[model samples]
Target: MKKGRNELLAEEEKILAPYAVSSRNSGSRAYEEPEHPYRLPFQRDKDRIIHSHAFKRLEYKTQVFVYSEGDHFRNRLTHTLEVAGISKTISKVLGLNEDLSETIALAHDLGHSPFGHAGQEALAELMKDKGGFEHNKQSLRVVQKLERRYPDFPGLNLCEETLLGIMKHGGGYETTQLLEVRRTLGPSLEALVVDVSDEITYSAHDTEDGLESGLLKLEDVKQLSIWKRIESSLPNSEKKSDLHSHSISRSIGRVLLNLMVSDLVDTTHQTLSKHKIESRESIAKAYQNKIKLVHFSEEFQKEFTELKQYLFQNLYRHPEVSRMSERGKETIYLLFKHFETHPESIPESYRKREGEDGRMRIICDYIAGMTDRYAIEKLKREGILWFPY
Candidate 1:
């Protein structure tokens, strides 16, 4: 049986590029690891994402609340897991690479800061002269340069396809500062599914999380005509204030899943019938529109703008989170300053692996990836990293 068609499968000549992160996949795939017992190529990618310190810090990073008063709120880690799960489920149903899908989903949020975007925004503002920072770019930082367990490498050394998916997030053929999803990757087959899955997962989940966190209400959705149109286009569901977010998420998930399944299946069937192959072009056309409609809806833009403002004004810019943000920026900047001043203090392993360029970027990458709580802990234990001589 054939592994389902994707961008990689569409190439006329099967010229496999050398991927730093090898495939950790299972039975029936021709492109899986060759007799490597410790892991499959995809498994390695998934494991790298799971074991990284960035993944652990996600527990404290924001999904909605900056530093929500509750334990059950969906932190960045849980959110990533949810997105990964959704992406994996869809990828599997569509016969795409589940590990790669999960890899992209899990690592997507690694670059986000302690207070989520608020902390991220503050940091970006502080460092505006230094090329600025974006969370998606930071996720790339995590994979390529942050995790230090392997004695040398900075990142998890992920595969090219996974990297492209991480970069593109299913938007356009060009890279932009606005959304990590807009970056251009050469092929559509592999990139489309992973990127769309991220949108399908996060849009539904964030809306649910926002409502659950008391930041949004059904009334908010009900207030807008266009949103109402989109909502009416989706399935119906009962609303509970406390459970509104998850319920909306569930309702929306069903709609999204049905859309993806129907589109992929219809496209695949049509491709098989017409061209005697699973049609990447057909599925690409069908799924590409989803990026514009479901992911980039004006209704979503208005709500997210509101939410971003609310979080900054209330939750993130709130006194508590503000204190944490100050300390976070201090920790990041000071840590970088420390490395800048005393390059000798840098870990010998990291130093040996990377020269000056590696030394400089690695510190920023590591500190920027930390959550508010984790950064505070590091600060407390290590004290201010910078030493002015």
Candidate 2:
């Protein structure tokens, strides 16, 4: 006997917290369709995100290091997977809907440009007079209008809840495009969990990648209070070799993950108790009142901020990273300017579609969707690489 969607919904109602957004309670999509018989709405949304063209493109997208730099560094795809994994873990511990959390985590970065933040900055600067480029807004656009998957709908036509979660996760650029999702003040618990998980992942994994790439030295990290604490906790006999350095980074990641998750759960539970938030409606009211329920403790927040500042000063701003970023920015800028003058080279779907912002936005979409290799190839194809500007 097969357990159907109804059974799954029933199980979710029994297990999920009163404030969790269950599949059964999901809002309708723009173009309404019959619910799936075999799977919940969130589950179907998750599957849709996994199969989308944008998801596959993430493989060649940058996460600090471009694909040509090294195969070992984390691409957008791996980073998304890591965020999903951590989000699900935290969601499970907090009694939230794991499917919803995982779905949002997976789709959170779908709007990132080819060369990561550097590429995004370039695009944003180019379109500064226009609507401007924001990855979070672009993410919303990907699901809402860009993806042409269905006959009845232009985009994926995902559940409203799933769309909202993706838009609110990570607290990035906000969008007013969707009137339905516009009023939300804070994200749901599941989305909040994903956001924190995203923070945990990059703060730790980027450090690991930096160390592995020789851009960041082990001695430099030891000066940070958090790293010192994590390093000292290791066994005294552990020799300080490459393996030792790797272990220290991993330990720092693990310790920070555990510490943040624990504090978040505890703080959230306390807030929920203090406010007596027993239902979805009450949770919404809490958010409307500007109360952020999911959060690390005050002590941990300071430490995390300090760690981020240290990383920004040392790792992210290192000369090697900065140089690569500059190259990436220049690459995106040239590709965009080339396509602007040569619109025929742009693809049909992106070009033909009557977007809200017109040709410039359409061009922006085409460039934003490109992978690192694709962008580089496009630049080379136009013979733009030969110029020594």
RMSD of each: 8.4, 2.5
Clashing pairs in 2: none
Give all TM-scores, in the order shown: 0.62, 0.93
Q: Write the per-residue lDDT of candidate 2 for residues 1-389, one digit (tens) a residue.
A: 78987787897889898888888777788898988888888888999899999999999999988888888889999999999998998888778899999999989999899989998899989989987988987988898888888888888998878887877534345445454353553567888788788888898788778777777777777776666556655555443546545665565566666666777788878888889887777877887888878887787778778888977888778888888889888888888888888888888887786365588899999999999888888877877763321
> Could you tell me which 10 consecutive residues in candidate 2 have the lowest summed lDDT?
171-180
Candidate 2: count of backbone clashes, pairs at least 3 residues apart or interchain: 0
How far residue 263's Cα lies from its native spot in candidate 2, in Å, is 2.7
Which lDDT value does model 2 have at 214?
74
Q: Mind giving the per-residue lDDT tens digits that candidate 1 earns over 196-258?
A: 555555555555555555555556555533354345556444433333546664564455444
lDDT score of model 1? 0.55
lDDT of each: 0.55, 0.81
Candidate 2 displacement at residue 9 in angstroms? 1.1
* Alpha carbon lDDT at 343, candidate 1: 63
In candidate 1, what residue range of length 10 has the lowest lDDT sum?
12-21
